[model samples]
Target: MKRLFILIAVGLMSTAAFSQTKTDGVHIYNPEANAMADLKAATEKAAKANKHVLVQVGGNWCTWCIAFHQLVDTTVVLKQAINENYEYVLVNWDKDHHNDEAMKYLGFPNRFGYPVFVVLDGKGKVLHIENSSYLETDEPGANGKKKVGHDVKKISSFLKGWTVAAVNPETYKSK
Candidate 1:
């Protein structure tokens, strides 16, 4: 009887442990994902599509990261901008998996903070490291009580600025 009880307790504990890893439908970062592999795949896809790679580096544990992702996911303009200009991926960074190799390749974007944006060219070369704070709005959010969301315009502009055509020298040639 004692052994059965112990087994049940252990099962319950394991379930709880696993449940803590997920947020309430806002899990943008996958701790178990191979970020390096994902980034390589994104770069390849971007190259073929003539687009850039937009990597959002943060863990599901970060509230702001979740908020930013929620905004981008629900906003039509933001989604359009991303789809038109870049291949998007979320790289997890947290206590359990810091993704050290990915971080080094991305030029240590975490130095800025959680939810930092790293723009990479088709060849996997780092082009820009954007601190997410710059994309946030000074005014309060929809509830008009909390200043915890990103500005759609700012994010759209950022995405547009890093597109392949925007960076190509020939794009500016007088025709």
Candidate 2:
């Protein structure tokens, strides 16, 4: 029940939330081209479309990446919003296979942990970089990841805010 709010992948259902097609889950493109070339192309595409590109930096091994994927899968409103305004790309942070220099080129001169989210625009310029810890609080060490607690709501709101007809939170009362 509580877990449903974190959905990061959902189909493009009607506004009524009834039925959606199979392609709702993010296409999650692979080496669409050489990393830099792909990044450049994605940026060009985003810019031409006048929308933002969401680049998720993590591979199959990262736990938070898995969690993020699950959340996106279930986050209906966010999915809809993303489907509307943003083009998403995932930069694989492969450890053993090794893409270190590329990741550094992408963002981290030093390095960034898993689940690093770098948002870019059509021109390939960055819009936002959300790489904080999940807690967003000061802990012992570990750099205290930013809290993902209310972010589900925030992500949903951000998506809707970028759209034309925002989803009024109360209109789902029928549920």
Candidate 3:
């Protein structure tokens, strides 16, 4: 019984550490960071990867924002798609409106609500402004409870739709 208790305690501690390990600014959603700087950095990275920049605008205060983050972090296919095709940037929309200036440049995505998204091409041009609500599903949970989170298939499709595939000039032969 004592050994079992020790094992359980170790498991809990490891799980706690795993979750909190991503609390750094780059991983956790920070409201105080310069959103424009982050956008610029993401744009550069996306350009190098030939991927789009996915800017998620939201605050840590919002439950749905947290839920969306968790969904993307844990879902393997969704996470893989995001990793392979986008540079993810989390822009905060706190009550103090820390990054309002950047939002102005981004066309005020906060108007949609927390956890809205902006997609930018490799060159940093605005491709789309996503209202996250449309990406979610209103289905019953296993316990017959209604839970709000992103639908993996929808997210995968959305990512694929926005992803810019590389072009091989060699393939364009003269007719």
Candidate 4:
């Protein structure tokens, strides 16, 4: 009787663990979310705030996508730059849900690869398509091997370059 109870308890614990989903910091993308609606809403908010829309195109399953998000979240400069200039949105694209309408609206930014970035004006016009690979840095890991991740300075520069003020005709006028 004791053995049977122990086995049942272990089995239940295993089942519970197996049924759990990945809910870490990396799981930023929701497969069920409406990408088009999210983009529209971000654009609307950006229009009102006089900012641009920064759309991150990737799935929750993508490690680089999560890493980039984590880096931006943890880094003060990057977070401030994004907050000051853009309304950020993550549009999930996975095998089960392609988010076709959103992809089309973004000019097929995913053609570059997963974790692509589409910078849009307040009016939803595509200003730039950034392949995330370009923002990555190859640094020596603890194992003495090259490990790649997004570079903070590069990302900050990118964000600054696309800001509304950066693109304004008046900003470029001779003082």
lDDT of each: 0.93, 0.58, 0.82, 0.92
Estimate the overall C-alpha local distance difference test score of candidate 3. 0.82
How many backbone clashes can be found in candidate 1? 0
List the candidate 4 regions with Cα displacement exceeding 4 Å. 1-26, 142-145
TM-score result, candidate 1: 0.82
Residues 1-175, candidate 4, lDDT per residue (tens digit)? Answer: 9999999999999999999655355668989998889999999999999999999999888878888998999999999999989999999999999999999999999999989999999999999999999898777889998777988888988999999999999998998
* TM-score for each predicted model, relative to the true structure: 0.82, 0.58, 0.75, 0.83
TM-score comparison, 1 vs 2, better candidate: 1
- Per-residue lDDT tens digits for candidate 1, residues 1-175, read 9999999999999999988645666666889999999999999999999999999999988988988888998999999899989999999999999999999999999999989999999999999999999998778667877576788889988999999999999999999
Predicted structure with the largest lDDT when compared to the true one:
1
Q: What's model 3's lDDT at 18? A: 87
What ranges in model 3 sit over 4 Å off?
1-27, 142-146, 166-175
- What's model 4's TM-score? 0.83
